[model samples]
Target: MKRCFLWTLTLLVSVVLVVPTQAQEEKFIKRKVAIGRFTNETQYAKGLFYDKENDPMQKQAMDILSSKLAASGKFILLERDDLDVLMAEAGENMQKIGADYIILGSITEFGRKTEGQQKVFSSTKTQTVEAGVSIRLVEASTGLIIYSDEAKGFAETTTKQSLGLGGAAGFDATLSDKAISSALGQLVENIIDKCVDKPWRSYVLSIDDGTYIISGGASQGIAASDSFVVYAKGKTVTNPQTGIKIELPGKKIGTVTVLQTLGDTPETEISLCSYEGEPLDSNKLSNYYISDK
Candidate 1:
């Protein structure tokens, strides 16, 4: 009886020493994103004499892409345009935008060509417009270019049996818009696919005793009992070709549990627990990150 009791106590101690693995969480994880100002590279300034200030082609494309990304339920759209104001007014403490990635876009091609003009006998005129954009999704913490893709779309409109009414037609003016929208659609899809394949990450905005504030809630498909692996983010490495910095993979420090999901605002404060190997250091919360387990 004494030997059996000792063996049972040993098994119990071993079980207590082992940390339980967290079950797999959400089926789909959402990442936070910020859209940056995009540049227009088309050759309209030197020759075409089109007004670019009021309705810039690059701004138009940016708006389209932003709208599409916002409509897609895959991302948490954060505002990057007001970064300067936020820093100046709220200071660095308010600098945490809860964004995981940032998007930079450029309009590489934006032009319209009108060919086969109406002649004495030939009353058919064809107008073709093409718009192309290159997009880069950068990991905000490391500035790594996680995904890069370029898509071009073309729109053609032909006016037949016209009596020199091409000038009054709307095809020339609207073709560019149509083409831009089409290209942006493809870019949005590319972003979604890449993001889906990647494991999502969240940040520890602040810590309150045993509770840690994070940036995911019901909107991101997170809920109570969800588990995460805590890590410390490392220095960002630069991509030599593109000169974009990418965050290096972090070292696992500890684990956290979702004690409760914050109200309807897509924010939550979770509870921290000792990691499997080394106990998590509270002081090294700087550059700390969280990934779903």
Candidate 2:
């Protein structure tokens, strides 16, 4: 009896380990993001040589944030540097390639200082740079700001010379990059959390030959045979005091199964899905949307 019980326990352990291995991994859907505008509002901008039209500090902050987001491999970064030109060129088509969220930022504080300690036979010089960054996340669908926060970064370097033999440090220009990178790093996780706080959403683009065409593709973590729930948007009511229109909860209407994907790039990618239940009204497509199960 003891031998049989021990064998059963061993089988249970084996099944427990194997079951986890057979489980499918959760998919990571990529979110589309754009940096709308980054401005320099720091005291350094008041300097005599500062240029309002072309500020290096503002560009630097954007670049740092962009690099961090790209490295995470969880977002499709879009360009908005020439937003006006892009709008004019794309016109109404801009809606197809629009970002899910827009980030507006400002460099609020920036400064550097150097300290030197002198002695009879030895001396030390230290350089420090600090940067403050503020950002706001705007929902592209509603043009409303959803999240806002500020972060600070600091970097410093020290050099010591004994009997004037050690190396001398100059302006330490790289300190600025390090400081800005640090500040943006502190905010990257929060930005990601806020951006993904809600479930991902997509909409039906068109119906072609009975196949439902929808936004997003394999590049956005969508795959063939994957199922998504279809929802009909709820009614909208305007607040009496605030005058802000609020949308009611949505209703689950049906489901869709991915048939295939099209397009070469994420910007133009589209998925072909087959509806599971009764056909939906094509003319009322504006009221329908797709979301994760």
Candidate 2 whole-model C-alpha lDDT, 0 to 1 = 0.83
Off by over 4 Å in 1: 1-26, 45-55, 83-97, 117-122, 162-171, 232-248, 263-278
Q: List the residue pairs that clash in candidate 1.
A: 143-245, 144-245, 144-246
Instruction: Report the lDDT tens digits of candidate 2 across residue range 1-293.
Output: 99999999999999999877767577668998988568888777467887876888887888989999989888999875676565456543445336777788888889999999999999999999999989888766555567888999999999999987998977788898899899889889988988877677888889877899999898889999988989888897888998766768788988989999888887788999898765778988978888885
TM for candidate 2 is: 0.89
Mind giving the per-residue lDDT tens digits that candidate 1 earns over 92-206?
A: 2432544666677888887888876556754766799888889988665544577999999999987666554444434567777889999889888888887777777776666
TM-score of each model, paired residue for residue? 0.70, 0.89
lDDT of each: 0.70, 0.83
